[model samples]
Target: MIEILKPTELPLARETGALVAGILQTLKARSVVGTNLLDIDRQAQAMIAEAGALSCYVDYAPSFGRGPFGHYICTSVNDAVLHGLPFDYELADGDLLSLDLAVSLGGIVADSAISFVVGDSPQPESVALIDATERALRAAIAAAGPGVHIGDLSHAIGKVLNAAGYEVNTEFGGHGVGSTMHQDPHVSNIGRPGRGYRLRPGLLLALEPWVMADTAKLVTDADGWTLRSATGCRTSHSEHTIAITDDGAEIMTLPKG
Candidate 1:
């Protein structure tokens, strides 16, 4: 289902976006060395409750997942990439961590993700992987605008990841979000330009670009949710929820602080 926000509803969408971004930022700050994944989940839960917002992941029981996520945020570390179920694990220096969050406030939803090193470990590979994803996200956002094809955004993201020598994973890319967590218009990380859905004002899209160091293949963890690289190599993911406008695309999830 593709949900579009009316002009009057844009403010509420922005509010939801701010809440999601703030929580993700807060989680990143506290995810230093020795931070436990469970602790991160708890922190996310508290922040969402304090903001009077609902976590999209908590009740998210998709067929691909084990059940209703039962967690606040996705804590993907090192080899883990997507749907990372929080568990008993403390972060270590040089560990790559990705925090993906989505929340609903005033009945509007926004989603975003960020990947970074846990501590100052001088891990060049981790830094490079994160940089690639970040750049791809920016590239995709830059390509977004009214009348543009969804595949154009995907092409932009693919150009960056492929140029950076990383394989792109399309199994789980970006998607539409509004009034709910996930919606129509599957935005792949790689695609042919001028194909797929066309952009329109009031449309919200979550563009995420993630890559594994060695392979595009993924392996599911025994926990039934966490997605990891097939080769056990490091990975990174970056995402943002953007709104299509008459003139251009507006990023709704930028950190306010």
Candidate 2:
């Protein structure tokens, strides 16, 4: 379903977005070597509860995933890319971890994701992958505003990832968000400009660009939720939720001080 926020609803969306961003930032800071994925999930659960927010992940059972996600956050490590279910695994130095989070507060929802290297061993390839996704995300956001086509945002994002030499996957990409976590106006990572849904004020979109080092193919983990690169190559993902306005897109998920 596509949802457009009322002017009055935008403030709640911003509050929800900030809460999501702050929790993800905190999780990233604590994801050190030897930190277990379950611990990270617990931290997210605690924070969400303290903030009086509801997790969009735990109990989330979409058609694409196995029943009930049963976790507070997604913990993707190294080869893992999207929808990574938290498990009983300890992280290691040099591991590339991606944390994707979404939450609802005051009846509005916001979503975002970040990928980074754990510990001190930041590999060049890992850094490059993360940078490419981040740049793509920025470009996409810059292209978003009232009357802009969804394809324009997709094209902007695709240019960065493609130039970075990584293949783009369209199976899973950005989408609309509002009262619920996911919604209409599916935003692919790559596309032709001047095509697809037209943007409008009060609309919220979650723009994410992710890529695997070598291939566009993905494999599902035994857990039935984690998506990993077919070649086991490192991967990265970056995302943010933004609200379209008359001036331009207003980023909702910024870390709160």
Candidate that scores best on lDDT: 2
lDDT, each prediction: 0.93, 0.94
In model 1, state the lDDT of residue 62: 96
Q: Provide TM-scores for the models.
A: 0.99, 0.99
lDDT of 1 by residue, 110-179 (tens): 9999998888884889999999999999999989998999999999999999999988877899999998
> For model 1, where is the 10-residue window of minimal lDDT?
116-125
Clashing pairs in 2: none
What total of clashing residue pairs does each candidate reach?
0, 0
Runs in model 1 lying further than 4 Å from the true structure: none
Cα deviation in Å at residue 99, candidate 2?
0.3
